[model samples]
Target: MSRLAYGGDYNPEQWPEEVWHEDVALMREAGVTMVSVGVFSWARLETAPGVHDFGWLDRLLDLLHAGGIRVALATPTVAPPAWFYAAHPEALPVTKEGVRYGFGSRGAICHSSAAYRQAAAGITEQLARRYGKHPAVALWHVHNEYGVPVNACYCEASGEEFRSWLRARYQTLDALNTAWGTAFWGQHYGDWAHIDAPRVTPTVGNPAQQLDYARFTDETLRGNFIAERDILHRLAPGVPVTTNFMTALSQCDSMDYWAWGREVDLVAQDHYLITDGRRTHVNLAMAADLTRSVAGGAPWLVLEHSTSGVNWQPRNPAKRPGEMARNSLGHVARGSEGAMFFQWRQSRQGAEKFHSAMLPHAGTANRVWREVVALGADIGALAGIAGSRTMADAAMVWDWQSWWAQNLEWRPTEDHDARERADSFYETLYDRHLTVDFAHPEADLSAYPLVVVPALYLATEAVGQNLRAYVEGGGTLVVSYFSGIVDEHDTVHPGAYPGALRDVLGLTVEEWSPLLRGERVRIEAADGSVLPADVWTEFVVPNVPRGAEPVWTYADGRAAAGPAITRHQLGRGAAWYISTRLAPEALDTVLAAAAADAGISPRDDLPRDVEVVRRTGEHGSYLFAINHTATEAKVPLGAAGTELLTGERAAGVLAVPPGAVRVVRAD
Candidate 1:
């Protein structure tokens, strides 16, 4: 723990025994402090039922220890051996369409199957017992990404499990019926045995039922993880146990990190860029911030990212020169203990053969290998920042449950995407050089001066009250459209639209007016400035008695002359609401005004796309200035310091080359 953990997943089992010595030599050359081993070696290690082959792993760990590198020993339960599936075919997951999945790919086991759970536990315990006291093992990697590829199943075993989970949650069939609103469509269950998993139906299934199913699936997967984790904790007493999470909203949405975060001894996440032509660094920063928040602002690790391009995407392209280093350091700047890629050495033959790795197929002579060495050295220089906390100026309310509900079958418009809204708001904050901490809706808001609710299509009464109290307690609040419209049960809040937030926002939405695709509207501010908005418009009636005032009115739309944006003064704080989706520039303007009201300001002195963040801890303060622009950028430093990357003294201002990163240790 004295140094930042730098390395990637090391699958030595994929290579011959002699190749490991070379891997170790190259690892030392690249400054690899730690490497994860045996992530997908279940079949190799457990050749037969209850039989394990540990000789290869034993030699590998010994070699790594001799090379002065630590190991994150994995349980290798993610991909069970082919024998497991042959014995317990019932363990295979069945799709909602009634087709059962066969085992050629990973993560195909039904979590509800007792046979699968028992086998997974056996492997985990075996690994723990064998490597529990290994000197090179520094951490216990419970399993690979929990919710990747597959997290839900519709098998009969899963059906029974779902009923049990429901029984525990609702206690009685009557209560379940009421909660699920089964009275409609005459779908009420007369007996417990009648209830089944929300499988493919003639029409859209009950939204409440589907939401509960999602929750059940998350808990089911977490239960499996906890089962393995408990075995690890009991067997490997001192070692920390963790399961990597895909915290990026775009990548994985099945697991609720707020719930999962509390389960792990350390929070670790895997983030990959979507490469959809948007500013990818913005997404990276958002994912890092979210992961840090999941870790409760403590430093976390980048368990898996691409060294260049991944093999999965539609048009995978190699990262431009220096982009790999910039991408890795970007996570470190936002509170990662270290950066790690999906793999150490590229594979010669596999589904992921084309995936980028620390050592590509081109071997040590490639740009990837060279950059890998440089990045490893750079990370070693940032050892002091390993445990530091990344500072945040504001909190953004985000909940995976809400996202799940918003993505249900029917809604006002398919254009209403929670992730898009969140990305837009987070990107705007990023552009202003504001670090954000994502919080669950009901979490404490007193720590933050400003809180933004980007899109919460599903909000419970607790969430509304929490926001109300936050604003009343002198915290500034900004809410986007389509938020606070429904309760946890997917039932529309009674009375007006956005019912839960009406009182706090000091406005009532009588009806939703969704714009057609590609349609636009214009809103005019009081200063005679106009901005275009799109996707949605609303008929908002502000409560004058609540000290609510319109800041911008609809200049041309279905709600012309109506308030497009309003601000309400409550207690010593203010709440701002946007009744429509504002353009990015317009959103920035509104957010800036709200930031000023909250006594925060943008870092306008820094060049555009330049990210400036600070990490402070027992070691002292460190400033991370990452230039994402095409030209050199300068960042002001109030004091003199040593640049960690180059070991050069920095004073007054720090000049960062284009596409480069600099970390300064404040003196």
Candidate 2:
């Protein structure tokens, strides 16, 4: 149960039966023990009705178990069998625009279709009945990136299902009209039959309808996941169940799925952070932190990291030396129970023809194979460090729904890139060695010493009250600009800055001066601390400025020379006010000082760019000091340690060459 669960995505079903042994031989050399199979073999499995194909899988499992390899059994529900889709064409999803989708891809089945549910349940039950007790079965991988099917259901089944879903949500068209504001353009729906999914592609329609459709898509797919999970758990009562979730997906509020914490035994995630040559260090941290948050700070897994370019990406860049390892350890350091790659072997053809693989088609002599072994050995050497947790006393609440609402704004508009900015914030905290949690806006915030809310644009009155309560209970709240403007449905609150939280903050904003892109302004704390010209600056005009004070101001002291960032000491708890959007340096500086004041500690050992990954285990704390830089970097350890990568123990400071890794045990 405690091994790192090495290896990933073996496709024995794709190759000739004879080549299976060669694959087994290679697995041993790479120290690989787990293979995710049956991800897209639905058509091949059930060529006809009531005819189950098990001989291949049975032999495959027997051979793998003999070779000491475990199976991350996939339900193969991601792609419908051609027979299933053809027989039940109604299982196809319809888009908001009313166009029907043709099948030729994975995850194309309608998530809410009864046909899909029945077929998927039958397949899962069969698999469980056959392999539940098999010693080789390790974990159940429900579906492949459940969000793959870009939404649009045209089938009658989906149409009826959509109506039912809407009924449960709004109850009646009157309520729906109020939410959709249907009276605006004479678009009021007299009947439910008149209601159809949005077609915003080439037409101008209400954005709210489109947004709700997107949210509904998330729920529909979530239903599929729930159904598959129930079947998997019932069939194999002891096996852990999980489905890989793509992080930072805006089309769906993937974060919303985290509320079903019990349905998932482990929080396994898929990340494709590389679009250009450079890595998104902050994005990586956000993915890991969000994944860990669901398990309530329990260790999660990096279920899928590409060995190279992904086919779906507009631009696929091959991972350079140390890039894969650095990314792999990035998750491990942040409470990852297991770290695995997307695929062990490259496919000759398909949508993923060029997707990078651990072992290339050229066999085991390539640099890719060599790197795989080196990574395997490095992780294997550090055996007892997967379950460790870090020392963190603070958290930040991230609300994706609110994030979407901000993007729907009319004035002072810009991209509501919460995923990127939130990552920026989290990455800065990590670089400063701060233990940060990505909590929900609705979660109880009393546990954390300090809370940082970036942009809660769509937050409700209840959310504001919750934050107020947390602050009144002696907790510090750090808020940024452009927050508290909207309701849960992306509707404006008809008030000033931080609309709903205004009363709680005891301030009224009269006017706000937009700090144009690249515009600079001075920040002078009421305590007499001053910093010159920060990016994304703004001025705050508080209604009842009793204890509220400005921390920074412009040098010229213009006519509106107020605090760029203000704060108020309300009761026992403190509410920090920030007017301008801060640059990285400014945010790090201000947050670091605030963190120190709140008694929060920074545990990352190296400077920015030098990654210090911490993992928990039964043995002791394992700190992976990885030099992601091309030039050599030095890291100072907190205590005496041993290098798990090389079995080298050290005291004081440790120097890591470029692209090198140092494993150490805390004293």
Evaluated with lDDT, which candidate comes out highest? Answer: 1
List ranges where model 2 is wrong by over 4 Å: 152-156, 172-190, 201-208, 249-255, 260-262, 409-411, 511-539, 543-547, 554-560, 600-605
Give TM-scores for every candidate, taking all chains together and pairing residue i with residue i: 0.99, 0.91
What's the lDDT for all of these models?
A: 0.91, 0.72
lDDT of 1 by residue, 77-101 (tens): 8899899889999988999999998
Please give the clash total of every predicted structure, in order: 0, 18
What is the overall TM-score of model 1 with all chains considered together?
0.99
* Angstrom error at residue 92, model 2: 2.4
Model 1 regions more than 4 Å off: none
> Tens digits of per-residue lDDT for model 2 on 1-667?
5578668788777689998998888988988868888888777777776689898999999999999988888888888777887798877776655666888877677777777888888888888889888989898888788666564454566656667778899999998888887887878988998776665444456756756765776678777788888887887889999887765433245335455554688777777775754356556766777777766788777778776667776777677777777777777777776568778778787777678888887888877788888878876775587567754457888865665455553546353355555655676676776667777777888888888887676778888888888888888888776677767655667767668877656565666555555555666665766565433444456655365655565443341466666666666677776666666777787777667656676655456677666665567877777676778777777788787777777778888888777778876
lDDT, residue 647, candidate 1: 94
